[model samples]
Target: MTDLNALEDWAGPLLRKIEPAGRAKLARTLAQQLRKGQQERIKAQRNADGTLYTARRPHKLRDKKGRVKAKAKMFQKLRTASYLKAQGDAKGLAVGFTGRIARIARVHQYGLRDRIAARGPSAQYEARELLGFTVEDQEALKDLVLAHLDL
Candidate 1:
């Protein structure tokens, strides 16, 4: 058999015990850093491909009166296969990453405000992946390294 230890190497030392506190700590750290970079990139830019990436959309709600709801902000939904059926039925928008995805892309709206709310960017991002050195930036490798860490 081809060596799968490389997979283990690609994974951190915590690969064998994803549920343990040590792995959880590393995952949280990595997730935080990853998310931060994405936010900054979106923030520094004005329009996301001229259509307003989810993080740049204007809030779309109004209060009891007609003042544009104070807290009504843009929304995004990142979905996976599990979320597909439910969000689709609700008329939510789904965006695909064109690569390996932990979950399907079912998020179809909103941006920063939604992201800041702790709900995270609403669009289902291709599952955060850690890939081989050779295909690092290929953008379509099916190997998702973060899967073990999160769920």
Candidate 2:
């Protein structure tokens, strides 16, 4: 994950220039934009660095013909705006998974070893950067800030 401290430093001056109400609005806008980008990337199954996510483990169940069943796309519901959220206030903004889903997201985000199911075997999931500051996001942040200032 990109260090947010750096972003805070870079954005500090520009954000300070805005009035409280405008800053709050800008924060909401930024959060929404970032959330949209993240949803797109997750749908594409790409990491923050633009690399393809490690494929999901193959299903164990087989068809009558003995072929393994094709796995469904990963994180379909999890990536939706309901499970994932974008919220902001005067202080700052955040785009992330909310509720219990966050625990599942964290498992994949850090490649942690966890149980596959209750009483099932544990496995190490590969790290998939579910969230991070990408290069494009950095540029977009700059553009958004400049545009907001212009308004």
Best by lDDT: 2
lDDT of 2 by residue, 55-138 (tens): 877666776776776677888898899988999878999999977899999999999999989899999999998887887787
RMSD of 1: 14.1
lDDT (Cα, 0-100) at 23 in candidate 1: 52
Cα deviation at 77, candidate 2, in Å, is: 1.2
Instruction: Estimate candidate 2's alpha-carbon lDDT, on a 0 to 1 scale.
Output: 0.87
The clash count of every prediction, one per candidate, is: 22, 0
> What C-alpha lDDT do the candidate models reach, one value each?
0.32, 0.87
User: Which parts of model 1 have CA positions greater than 4 angstroms off?
Assistant: 1-9, 12-14, 17-19, 46-151
Worst 10 residues of 2 by lDDT: 57-66
Model 1 residue 91 lDDT score: 16
Candidate closest to the true structure, highest TM-score: 2
